[model samples]
Target chain A: MDIVIGVDIGGTKTKIGLVDQNGECLEQTFFRTQDFPNLTNYLDQIKITSDELIQKLGKEVNILGCGIGAPNASSKNGTIENASNLVWKESVPIIEKLKERMPMPMRIMNDASAAALGEMLFGGAKNMTDFIVITLGTGFGAGIVANGKLIDGYDGFAGELGHVDMTLGDGRLTGLGVRGGLEAYVSATGLKRTIMYMLSKYMVESRFRDVAYNDLHGEDITKAAEEGDEIALKAFDYTARVMGLALANFTAFTQPEAFILMGGLTNSGKWIMEPLERYFNANLLEVYKGKVKLMYSKMEGKTAAICGAAALIWEIQDKPS
Target chain B: MDIVIGVDIGGTKTKIGLVDQNGECLEQTFFRTQDFPNLTNYLDQIKITSDELIQKLGKEVNILGCGIGAPNASSKNGTIENASNLVWKESVPIIEKLKERMPMPMRIMNDASAAALGEMLFGGAKNMTDFIVITLGTGFGAGIVANGKLIDGYDGFAGELGHVDMTLGDGRLTGLGVRGGLEAYVSATGLKRTIMYMLSKYMVESRFRDVAYNDLHGEDITKAAEEGDEIALKAFDYTARVMGLALANFTAFTQPEAFILMGGLTNSGKWIMEPLERYFNANLLEVYKGKVKLMYSKMEGKTAAICGAAALIWEIQDKPS
Candidate 1:
């Protein structure tokens, strides 16, 4: 039996799992990422936890490699550069440090890209050679797959579709300080912004009217829209319009077979998907109409992150260098 | 010495050339495409012209394959589908017919995609694996190369950047009847539209003011801008702003090393290039800033088309199936 170590490094918690060739998480453990302010301590803890997980298995297993999903990670350089969410503000040579202890093949990519690989390896995009995996969480991120491989581009910074300008500087500014980006209109933060904007513009009766801006969650909006809240419905509609148009523009670039969406926003289900599909079809160029399908990620939540990270190893094994 | 048959099928004329592996045209011939109303006759002429060019070489040379660049061509199916510019409105099995007569390996791609392959094989993008070729002719077109391969997408209709919506339906209508597309604001037709719009909006004295809409040409706009005509310069400025911003959005999709510009609009020289570069840089996301270089295509005019078509064969030979 062969198993690979999968690591998902989040802003707060870090998950480490032993994933089998069948995309099954045999065992997993986690630690508070913020607990280790020092880089060396954090790496040491990861090693300790990984060793314990392997020891607990109590069965003979060939360790294949390790795959990590982190913020601002570069697969080309095997480093994380200036991740806003992580405690480390500088470039971290993660792959190098991990290899010293693990003594196995390893790969690292940003969480979104890892998820894309996961989708390709074990999710709905299993047979797709060309598609896009959109991560709609606190921010927008995408992993573009073409010719059955991820497009790392010249500097391994390809598929930053979230930052693609949407409003030409006229719309809301994103956390990155860029104005009118797709991230400013299509992410969780963007959804909240739209809700706030609509609340001010329209006098629709809604539970969100009393909720504070920072306190409001994406789930609250989804719940409200489900119960026929006008403001919440409008917000979803607005977000869908922006995303649909952007996806249409994206279609012109690659004409992928489908766009597989994941993350918090997708939980809104028909609220976002219905309008998004309608608008996407409406905006697509004539040649591409009714051709591209919109789909949801088969994997869910934390399980998705771990499986996606593990998928990195499986992906590399299949491709020739 | 190995040579390939290169064909550039244009709306008005068709150019056939015998090109050596070195990207040199040893012999060439032309015929008016409009003269052949039937697809069979048109394909037969191509075969006849190819044989004539090979015979004229006057020496024994290995004919490797044939590469074709035409409107709405599909390399996957070896056919041309519903090209608006061509008189034949139905799908034409061009490669199947041509191969029957010539009996050689053949490939067909849209002209813009062929140009991208050309750039990779023998032009500015020779050293760069990731780049884009933008054709700013009567209409806008792009050829996206990532990971050392053209992104033909699932249906072989990728890289239609011109049809990417720019205005969400509020802007000018493109000839394809789509409103607010990048084509409506950045092509040769778009430049003329800009001039016309500027002339109507402003009382600036210019050579274009006296010229009728149909009489006006893209070169005239370039010449006028060269002489520092206010309206002409402003028109170039307007066109560049739209194009620059659109390119910035495109940059986020695939962070290519450079964007190679070609066609009539590029003839505007610094009038378009200067402000265009400024806007492109200004609009780029922080991560992508100053990373993507803007360049002009090395090959020019009819020679470019022929060589680009020839490059397709060379490109395939370099890659293993």
Candidate 2:
């Protein structure tokens, strides 16, 4: 059976996996991308890992294609433009670079878009024709699907749901140039800020204050909320409200079939999903009230990224030029 | 060339026209719907007019089909359920009734969707595969085209752009029960309300104060604006700002090739169009900026609606059940 090698490149770690036509993963592996000195060495390690996975899965499983998902990846130009997270010094022609070592047709897309494609292919939204996949990790991101097709605007940068206006606070004068946006409230930084604001109001003691800036993760807050913490619940509720309002604004025009939520904060499960679902329904137009479903990804967290990356490549190849 | 009869049934009047494949109106006629005592008489008038037009055009132009466009047309059901404006109290099996007289294939569709199809076929958006047609008549309405096709959704009521929130005044609400929508400022009702609000504040007035609600039209306001009226200009600017923000919100998701503005008020031309175009460009997502074109429809006034209604019928016949 023909298979595709899917790669998910991040600042800290890089994940690789073999995906079949049915979106089933055969063998998956991971390595620290930061360990490599440069792009060449990093890609060499990836090739070695790919070879190992192929050997384990049997050499008869021909690698038909390769798909890579990364920050600032441009599907139109087939390049990975300089990303602040990655150590790369210059724009990298990812498709061309991968061709030299692997010798197969390849495609690369933004990680958020890949995640959306993954949700469409193997996640809870497998049967949905129109939906938006939102990633709430370090920063909020989204991939939009309309009329059963992925929307890549003139510049291949169509889905920017996070950047849409949501805030009405004094902190609008931040790094992001936009006036009001969803990213201001839903991202990891946004959650940290929310926690800090709450801390000033209440004399609370928690593990969050100790590792506040350096090593604190979004999951810690979710865990704290799971233990019946009020502050954490407030933060989650705030994020869900803004996300829901933004989704309502989006549904006004496209009216998608569903919204698929992912990323680290989504692990909060009902703490985040239930409120988000409620607010989204409340804000929806009467005709669209009971139409859109809110779903969470069922695939293992790691597999979702790679599967999404693979789906991006598959989708690009299938579309008419 | 084969010809088709395109019938546009409005609340107060009915227009019947013979349209060719090239979208040319070979022969046309109109009559006041109030003249007919009942739907039977109204339909008989249409039959008589159509037969006369067909006879005048001669046997050389064979009528191949018929298309109808109305307010509450259900493409799925091939009938126009009772429209609020129309006196018809029961569902009109329009196609089945009209078919007996014409002896040709017939189809029916809602007016807004038909307008979208008309724009796609012969208006300013002729060559584009993806775009939106915004009708700014008594009420604000829209028909969206994405991925080269109109979105019918699950219930065939997909493109409802007017009801989306605009967030102007807290008291303003959409037909869907949402507060602060585009229709609050962009439609004919919206413009009149805006003018009335301005009248309470501004001292300058020329002709609007004594005008009857029925006689108050967008053209009168446009004429005043052209004559250098301050209140008219302010009203246009305020309307433009609201429309611009709404357009920005829409382009954030479904980045259609263009937004074609139609209906009565769009005749205000540069007064409304210039400011709206300016604000749309200034506020759009940086990536989507300049990608979407704002243009007026080549079909203006009642003729466009007739054409749009006709196109709806043609579209229904072309689609498979």
Name the top lDDT candidate: 1
TM-score, every prediction: 0.89, 0.81
lDDT (0 to 1) per candidate: 0.85, 0.73
Kindly report the docking quality category of candidate 1. medium
Write the residue-wise lDDT of candidate 2 on B104-149 in tens digits: 7776766667788888776776777677788877567777776667
Model 2 has a DockQ score of 0.25
Per-residue lDDT of model 2, residues A1-321, tens digit only: 788889988765788999977777778999987788587898888899999999999769766789888865667888876554467844688788878998988888777788888877777776777777877665666777766777665456556655554432123422235556557677666676777766767777755656655565677888888887777878778777767767776675666777777777777788888898887888876546687877776777768888888886666556686
* Number of the top DockQ candidate: 1
The true-versus-predicted C-alpha distance at residue A80 of model 2, in Å, is: 5.7
Count backbone overlaps in model 1: 0
Candidate 1 lDDT over A182-260, as tens digits, reads: 8888988789999999999999788988999989998999999989999999999999999999999898888899999
Least accurate stretch of 10 residues (summed lDDT) in model 1 chain A? Answer: A168-177
Q: Compared with the true structure, what per-residue lDDT tens digits does model 1 show for residues B18-98? A: 888778888988999999998889899999998888899888989889999887777788888766557897578888888
